[model samples]
Target chain A: MADATDSSDPVDALLATVDDGDVAFDGLRLEPVADGDDGRFALETPTLDRSTFGRSELRDVLETVEEYVTNWYYWQGDVGGEGTARRAFLRWCERAPVVGEAVTAPSAETTLEANRTARETANGTAPETTAEADQSLQVPQRQDALRDGIDREWGQLCITARFVDVDEPDGVRVYDLWHVDDADSDVADLEVYDDPRTAREIATTDEDGRYRPLKTAPTLPSGWAFTGLSGDELVETVGSVYPATIANWHRERLGELDVDHWLETAERQTGIYDVVDELPRDAVEWMADACCVDSQCLRRREWEYEEGDELDVDGGDGPFPCREPCSLVVAAARKWAILESETERTYELELTTSEFNQLGELIDAVAEGRTDEIREADLGDGANRYRARYLRAKRFDDDGLEARKRPEEY
Target chain B: MQALVVAAHGSHLNPDASDPTYAHADAIRETGAFDEVREAFWKEEPHFREVIRTLESEEVFVVPLFISEGYFTEQVIPRELRLEGWDPEQWDSDGTSATEVTLSVGDANKTVHYCGPVGTHDAMTDVIVGRAERVTEDPDVGEGFGLAVVGHGTERNENSAKAIEYHTDRIRERDRFDEVQALFMDEEPEVDDVTDFFESEDVVVVPLFVADGYHTQEDIPEDMGLTDDFRLGWDVPAAVDGHRIWYAGAVGTEDLMADVVLERAADAGAELGDAIEIVRAGAGGSVTEPADVDGTAGTTKTGD
Candidate 1:
């Protein structure tokens, strides 16, 4: 088994990690590609395998995975920057327990911080400028708090507290705190106090009025707590509310796969085929000389099939080229069979051949607006019953045929 | 071939509310254009669910016989028909855009085209004009006569008034009458104030409704002082308040509406061929070209 970190190229390094054995997670299997791009990969399941699909098919499958992952977690700016495939993979590893442990990838926060540092270093910035960079990052936090103040003054707000090594501002670590205040106005403007009671006093005190102590301490909102969660716990908390964002972050980390090719192969194997000489032949060619129904499907001159292989066909004697019946052929055959069977049966009619022709002419005359007379054929009981059924059938086809007849009153 | 279902907001107390709707269904049925012509209502017998149960065709077209694109047309009809892309529970008061939806019902797949209410069609304006003309002694000599279009306006939704206002504007554009005023039974300018807006001695009042239900037969006539009896059939020009008020039946009950109904069905993809002839034959009279009343000659607008 090849190790991921051994290769210089990140994609190659990741591909080398997939062993010969199947790696399954959430019903998706990451299988090694035998012949593909240098680091090509395939994802499969019981019913679907990327290796059997064509180029466009595989591409759609891969794109679906990509889109799903992107929508899930990467949508949140908290994850790695867009288009950073390596960082995206690392994020996936951190989220997907099986895949994450298999690759031994670093945490999402660590990778995020590392990428940021690398980006800053590439921009020709010195290590000493880290302190200035930290200050700029705090701007968003301040803006969020200010906006929250304008919207409402109630509820517990989350605030971050930073404790820096006094001698080294660059060696700072941050901690989060849930700030609960009962004040109805300017909650953002109040200074941080020891607890909710003190915070409320400073927030509620009028500009010209003296500070007064409350008789009863205010109760915090149900879930309010002094200590805040961080790292994985923080990611999990955010993921719970925005599952799509989390799913994207995890999927993108699974690395890229050749999805279009796999999809095409899968489609070719599933559609209608002609069973002849105990082999599956192109059903389209045998039935109709037309391309596959799928507009984007690849036109194949020959389809490979093995003898005695149980093809997925309706009412087929054995494993043959034609696996299943196309809807067009089945419908045509069914109609033809019905017509053939109906021709064999005879109906006793009371009307002569000449009278039947007159009836047809009269019906046409009414439809063409030549006459308004509604004349009924005076056939006997059995024939009249059959005529009524025939009229009912015609009514189903042309709702207005009978209406063209003038009533007896007219 | 598709099944055409005429969906109506049926009445519980007044059975006559769905009369025009049923008449329209019979007219369409005679046309022979659709495989099946059925009537479905929100509140009456042969309910929507029951009507859907009898649908054997794979494609269906639901034409709402509403006077306007109001709450019933926008929400109720679509829900009852199971038209694609609509969820009655998900609907909000903000209103939804009128778009046709294709949905599947049971083993058969159906593309349901929920058309606009018949009253909103431009052709209906011609029916209203025809109804007004029929009741008046001489419709051509209309230089001094007033036309009052009565509608069942509601305080619950503003769409009812909007529809009436639209017809009033269309009628005014014709320049046939001296004055055309849109009055509502519920909202302002109330139907009771019909005489206030007109100075003409002879006023032709046409009900812009689908049927001669409670509102059109009872409420509108009583408000306009056309009849104090509160009966189902009021004699035209019931001399009242020193003005000769010529009361007409609901615009939807006009024979010309059979053409509009077929036009609506055709808009929903029902082929119009022998069906047109069928409607003409059933009408028992010369079928007026829909182009004559649709305002836009040769152009028929369906589903609004």
Candidate 2:
């Protein structure tokens, strides 16, 4: 219930003015009383004074309790008046969004978004991680890979390549390079090319038509061509063009006919998969693909006969919501994610992606100093040393370091 | 193919109020990552219903241009986009059409896989910094010395500050800046506190509000002691004493906002494929349903 003494004087004044502005609302409902006391004038909405605007004008509605606050703390009762004003404010504070929510709503979320937009133009000290991440992210990775391929082939094709044209359907764009270069340099992975190698490749193709990795760095073209090259002499440049494979999509449900067949068959024949089984192999496969969760992982967790060693957690995906609202799960998952993320960095492999990686991939994927990529690869195979579930542990040295392993493995 | 729709809470009282947003949209459209750029508002020429009704593309990428993720972001935009109860495959208006519409919270398509709103881009900070530069560029003629950023700060959304703070911080970093501060139409670092808190040479007060409305024209000026716009000879001081002040039009007042709004109608020429055939929807930016402005909505140029 609202503070009994609020009197709706200040709030009422706000409503009156805001309404007079004729701010059209899809559904505007202002309930003077949240306690469901509509008939009584004791809790009449400030807008109730209008003859055209009826009681229902505030139904299915939004409660925009805009207090004519002198300061930001008025709704929070921080202004500190003794009697009715303070009491009413305390009640207002009850309805006022919590401090964290307000902060998250106003600051973190807003800053993150606007910072993203102004990222290109704004000259602000890249305040925090999110902005930094965008800086790295905006760099086209696939193009970088192609450039890297070219660089390895030709030797630092062009790291200083200004974007001549990034938006191209040809899978490649051209950049004007001052010089031509040799194509076979292994250091390609260390750089970025001005244009996709294909563009340079086409322009400087030798008579044999063999893609000379190090085509002499081509002559300059117009608009944001390779400006200046730093490090390593040779006016000649080597390059490679690698196919942009669809790698690690955030969500992908594809090429799983086997599971779909299983689901369809089960849905028709036994009819059990629909009710009892629910998730047919095909359906599970699709979900796995959609979620980017491995089919093997899904299969291992679902099968009844599997040892506890196969599963990471006791409950499987049940604990996770396939759907969201999930604020609880999202928040919890965020903690685990953050832990994994930070921990992954120390690993030799660079488990989680971060902006700093562009400084270069992590030396290792150390979940707990487990040396990232190498460690995970070394711990390879879907083999389970645990009791019932599969143990997905990376090697600290040879043996896994921490965390409760699968039951059988334990 | 992401169709970026810059949705806004429109104003019924005035059309010019939508100008700033259209301007911003125009700037974004030139970037060209979006398959289409459009704007949907609660009011003004093209109402929300007509905008959504006009979506010609299979998918729409909605970016709520609101500064906060409050009632509008959480409730209204999602509700309007019909995001509630949407199954991924069927999340679109026609389910199987591949015509999809995603509601990006703020501009983080980095996580969502879709190219989202410009808010997340560091490049956009350039706009704010640029806007501020406009004020600080000249004192007697342009905004010089004192720089005041007037934003609509809400306690509910910390995001509103991202724009204000980003611009303020960026300008403050410059050598030319005498002083750069942020003031809100609402909440803390408010208009009232401008004189007491901020210390700068010449004040250039830029309205963070998307449009010139009650707050920008009426409230902000009144708070800054320019209470009387009607006076002629006195010369409206951008600031009092050494603290000079200037006014930068709302960031949203760009001409592109109109294109963003017009883009919502997929059939509206700016769309891909087959031309949008409307009877009288010819060139001048006019519409019959919600009333026109001598020109048809679809035929109007992309932005102001």
Candidate 3:
């Protein structure tokens, strides 16, 4: 720790502000000692027991806090930056809120309740208040209460914040990032990554070791965590796992995201992808419904059919904006366009009601990529591998489904 | 004047998709021709749509390190970079390649010159011949060996096949190989018919692709009957039916690609001034002479 009087270092500059009385910030409390020459200070946090410290020891404690707060400001920018998604997320981590309505409104309610208790006491009768009302009066106490750990799900990532020392909030505060699927596993069990580039390697494959052509696909592999990351390191590691997501999320909050819709994007295609423009308008809506849903991609689709012409489908509920149709969507649209060109045909096949519903379940399982999740032992599920095999064995022939010939043959 | 941006298509599943672009950029950066050499990818970090915002450079040279001039080179890259006079309507109507496009970026109106892809350059024929010749140890120097340039051709884009045919014709004009044919992975006269395409005892197959991903690593070798079970970095020079087959790695990942990228930039009118001279001019406010940058050479292995 540098000299506490030094005005240049950020931590020192902040500590120098503690003068006569106690000061509180982000759950840490500091009080200046009466000893003038020693420049001692008393410190306390929700978890850390109250203790007296000389200048150097106090400086060491404040250094770690200053680093965490400084990095938070650097990556998160001003606390009041626009967009409520990240702001709500930060508040969930026990950090102070940008808008203090949630904090200040409760204090006002307690103040009103406190005045009622004063009036009851002045009536010369034993003052009585319900425990529920008394709980509201302890607003400041709630704010000072110790929190063991906090976790929130952002897209596929499970972000966690925990105190590093035994019951010492002033000690190092560490953050961990991992796949939400691995939330139940021990940190020691998961593969650990310190560098941001390792996140890229982990994001390259799925649970069954298949290449994930789309990073936003709902098939992220589990069993990995990036622990003990600083604020900027956490942000950088998350960005590597899902590139441009943080930037786009921030841009959406700032109201500066530029969205290129489907028609304009398709019109610009010059080669084989040019056929994507030939898709019927209704088919385009189907395409968005198929590929842009939250079950398929993590990004919320911001682009519409044109500019203000919205598709009749629900765009995902992701915090980040898609901005435009991705390459995967374009590639899928091209195939759909050619398939749409062929004349439609209806074939007659005999099936029971249960078998008919099974076909729908089979399509849903494959479309949502949940076929792998259904186990062969779970034969009750229509999409179970052995169940589907039995259905295929019963209905499908070498010629076609239910031994039906091609429509052209008729 | 400020930086060289090598833009290419990247993969989320396969890191090998962008390895060649990164290697080429690193090789070019070593020459000290520009103050910075950065890479932008369609599917990776620093995406093409926002790569310019990451740069403080006022003037940049954008080279598309792709294999062909098609959807990406003519349309996707130009639009993403927001070129000044790029009219996609015009490209779609005429089906003509945009050899060079210049876009003004940021408040400073930074000059961004978008150069054509390196794959279609005439210099690629030399790289292809070098790849074919290097695969064999025969003292005959690939004189009697038939050469097959394999490409991932799709029915959706004619340009993919045209790129392969262009190199095959150029290589045939030299009269070096006994036979030259354009084989595709998805089109007619596929790579599976390599043995039937040539009657020569020895045949050299070169994949005219940008990177050694699934296509080059597994699919092509499996199609050629070279290996029944293929993995990454499969062995070459296997014998089948008394015919010697020499399979080369993807042509685009060659180390000499640095020079090919520079040639494409030079064709787009880039002034390759030495970075040391530029720095001296910034400090002293004047320069007596500007050194000419030597082109990069030599073949080195790609990817870690």
Candidate 4:
């Protein structure tokens, strides 16, 4: 509900906020990147750009990052030290949802309407989409495949993380990526090696502070039903969580302009700061982060909201594979189905009391996540349907009768 | 004869962690089906490498006791087991026989079939809910007050947390609590955060951890901001902050483990022929001792 003719141009203000680390989950991504050839980036690319630290420290920073990746014991707990940039780059990727089959620039008026819809969605109310997101997704798949061609050229990207442990059974090695290489840099993207193994090694961490296997992650999957659903829904959900200001704006501005258009804009433009070129700093960034749209990040990110701060959460209604501790039980059920595919279908998981309890315990032990363990039980059915159980507590009298207390006295 | 190795990621830190598998192995014995039933570990005695070699049976059914399908259950265990020659499609689901060892039985009756991990059953939800309820003395703790399930969280993979949430949701669906929240030690909505997360003026916290470790006695309650006398029973006085807190033993401590383990064994055995003979792990002494297993204080508690 920005003023139709406010003196302070919202875009310029928004861009300034992006520069100050504002992230919007409900509107267009408003990132201020170094736009490269032909207007993809902004002008700050060539000349000295805005930064808190000097460029002279880039090598030292990069080396510090290497040392941390190579050894957690060294710099993991250290503050103000240069570290991995993978996080910074991934944040960039999170904003830059690979655009495909370029369309003519959306008119300023069209964008204005889109931004409004995004604002509405930011307020936790539902806005039905007539235009299919499925359409956008399809466009990307076709274009990416077509552009890459049948005999595709694979691009190498370097990624790194802190080392937890190393286990090699067959030839494959999997490294747990806690801190990625480009986590601290303003440069939004990373250039990593294509091969997963090489990626692990090159982006290695040390024993004390960090380490990454030279291995790379698997190529992005072709059909992303589960993953896409999880991440996209989160993005959309956090985008739509009730923002205090937007709600206020809507309540007051309902009779002023086109409410529907505003709602639509907000819905489509979620995380505009996280994903766009010139996002402004606003309360929405703070709010949607609590709403957490990217499901993959749920149960994974750990930062406490200050006292008196309301939490925006990734609702329990997030995508599969869920974050921990929910993932612990869910993965157990999934493992039952997948490993025993020959006999038990997905529906007939034979969760023993102990494993079931273990799974539940793992979930409860977690600190922050939207959904509880129970939701996962109801997910897959008919063999794909999973089963789980945990230990129930109580004291038995000499008579072996179960004792009970009233619901409120305890 | 084919054999199924029930591999548990055993912990030397907490003996209770491995209790269920040992109990389950006993249940499988009464039916006398498998040529071999054993517990191997990633940490405890008889490590994975050692356990594989102990499988005198050629065709071994390697079943991991992990609650996740992540890297470990899928990639690491399979790789360690050298299952390239074993077609999952061809392997037996019952602990019957294996072809890897000429001595290994391959019959649905005699073969060693590897069953899936005991993580995907609806029955487990019942056990978890039941345990959470039993742990408190405060009537307010069970059916209505906010229920928070705390688990150990690590940044290794998303599957770990997914597995935990799967259980909490199950309990929530029963309509037992005014609110049910899943929190993690390493993640958000932490044990301490639950008190704040709870809009319900007061809440009962349940530690869903697998053992009676530092997390249970210290981290969990500390997070809850409780002080002295904040013992884990119903209406326990808080030592730090005088919050009425109920301490529940690790949900895994339910004493009915023997029965459930037996049921699983029977199910696996039934898949094979009905006339399988039970071979006890310790030929002389009973593995199914039905002796007291201290489920509390991590001590001996008789299985009901």
Q: What are the lDDT scores of the predictions, listed in order?
A: 0.46, 0.34, 0.66, 0.36
Tens digits of lDDT, candidate 2, B1-304: 4455667765533444455555555455554545545566644323332233222244565555554323454444554344534343332222111222333322122111122223323333444444545434432332335667777877766666665676567667764556677888778888766767656555656665545555554556556664444121112345454465555545444332333233333322234332212211222221111111112222211111
Between prediction 3 and prediction 4, which has the larger DockQ?
A: 3
Error of 2 at B217 (Å): 1.2
- Evaluated with lDDT, which candidate comes out highest? 3
- What is the Cα-based lDDT of residue B111 in candidate 1? 63
Model 2 misplacement above 4 A: A1-410, B23-36, B84-121, B136-144, B173-176, B229-239, B254-304
Predicted candidate 1 versus true structure: per-residue lDDT over A227-326, tens digit per residue: 2232233332222211122333222223211112211222332112111222224332332222222211111112222323322322211101111222
Best by TM-score: 3
Each model's TM-score, in the order given?
A: 0.38, 0.32, 0.63, 0.33
Per-residue alpha-carbon lDDT of candidate 2 for residues A229-253, written as tens digits (9 for 90 to 100): 3111111122121100011000111
How many clashing residue pairs appear in each of the predictions shown? 41, 141, 0, 217
Tens digits of lDDT, candidate 3, A348-403 = 78888999999899998998778878976998899988878888888988865864
At residue B175, what lDDT does model 4 achieve?
A: 82
True contacts kept of 1: 0.00
Tell how far residue B271 is off in model 3, in angstroms.
11
Off by over 4 Å in 4: A1-410, B1-4, B12-20, B27-35, B53-62, B85-116, B137-141, B199-204, B226-243, B257-304
